[model samples]
Target: MILTREAITTAVEHGDIVIEPFAPERVSPNAYDWHLGDRIRVCEGDELDAAAATRVSEHVIPAEGMVLRPGRLYLGVTHERTHSERYAQMINGDRSLGALGIWVHVSAPLGHVGHAIRWTLEIRAAQPVKVYPLMPFGKIVFLSTAGATASYQHLGHKYTRTSGIDISRLYEELR
Candidate 1:
């Protein structure tokens, strides 16, 4: 019971969902594209060998640098949390830092887990971001399609798409 564009549009009209500083060009038929922010926190430490990268402890090696270098991972935010929901957390680098590597952590499916969120992300160096990570990404409208259909047969039901695939295809379509 994923939401349709029209339902989402109407929900946005009523203020049930919110998004700010939207760019006019990125919305697609279903979801809006988000931008990267410039305030990145790098996880610096002993040059990690293959096994030391993943499973980073709760500790963080604070960085003062701005640019995300290759092979280095970063601590960042999630697309799902709001200012009210997210709590500060951190993750370590993956030795395989490059194209197709993780840019963040996903503890549960997206949307469902954000209500009371806590998890960290590991960002990679791929492009120049125009905003700050503290800023929210994507837009939200009411999305009537999530709980019901147009036929009026099934109404007020909740639905969610897999967060994994929603983003995996983003780069494919962008390319």
Candidate 2:
């Protein structure tokens, strides 16, 4: 089941989800909108395409963010880490970022732990910095649709949970 705004609020209130310097208004019907931190790494067109086949060997983070003036912000999404089988698909969007007004995601897949996604925010000047895990994906999408789910318990009296979302079918729907 996709989480509702009430569920999101409850989770945050109960300490199940946490985003530093959080705002209640950011919570949406099914996800939370994350603000752009003062940092980002923008891959060139070729670099962005290359990631589809090979991950980048070099990550260039500006010493400070670019073009950022005071109090301006970028927006993005966050994923709930409750489910261990973390899967994320972030597509681009259109929003003004001073002059470089393209949208992007912050993600490191597979065996990433301790490592973080860094970004640079350029307004009047550039200042590169780091942001932590997001609570939701910028409230852009909750799910392509309500996710189907199922769970079971183990014989040892332990409650082991599971999911039943058929991703293959989900893909067809998205396309």
Candidate 3:
């Protein structure tokens, strides 16, 4: 079952869900709004290979804002670091940002129960759009899990404890 806002609050209160730098205002009815971090890595190659791609240029979004052009992928990070001991976390694009044609997290949106990291956003724009650091661009919802589950750390996942925008680690698996 998906957790409600009250349940989320209760979980936080009971030390079940952890969101760093938590803000009361950022909590919605069922999810917590997350802000964009200052750093972004824009892919600079024409073709990308999941097992070989590594060419990217990092840019720090200025306070004024940075424009995201169409047909380009920008890997961004969330300002908040999150962890869930009991529930699986799912990150979704904020409706306000989506209305502006900004797509966050292209495919990988589900996180494991013990996933602890600052979310990496697979951002793309339908058109030209400007985004600022610390802007609320994503929302994370926690889902209840049943039975025994393994943590990403326990699994030795390459992207388990990332603190910033992490380039695809699929290449590591290929090794």
Strongest candidate by TM-score: 3
- The residue ranges of model 2 lying beyond 4 angstroms of the native Cα positions read 42-101, 106-137, 140-175
Taking every candidate in turn, the Cα RMSD to the unseen true structure, in Å, is 12.4, 11.7, 1.0
Backbone clashes under 3 angstroms, per model: 4, 24, 0
Best by lDDT: 3
Task: Write candidate 3's Cα lDDT for 36-107 as tens digits.
Answer: 999899998888888885789999999999999999989999999899878999998987988999999969
Give lDDT for model 3: 0.90
Model 1 weakest lDDT span, ten residues long: 82-91
Candidate 2, 78-149: lDDT as tens digits: 232222121121222224322243334333121111111221222122344233433121333232222542
Q: What TM-score do all the candidates reach, one by one? A: 0.41, 0.36, 0.96
**Ranking under TM-score, best-scoring first?**
3, 1, 2
Which prediction has more favorable lDDT, 1 or 2?
1
Error of 3 at 119 (Å): 0.5
User: lDDT: which is higher, 1 or 3?
Assistant: 3
Would you list the rank order by lDDT, best first?
A: 3, 1, 2
Q: If both were scored by TM-score, which would come out higher, candidate 2 or candidate 3?
A: 3
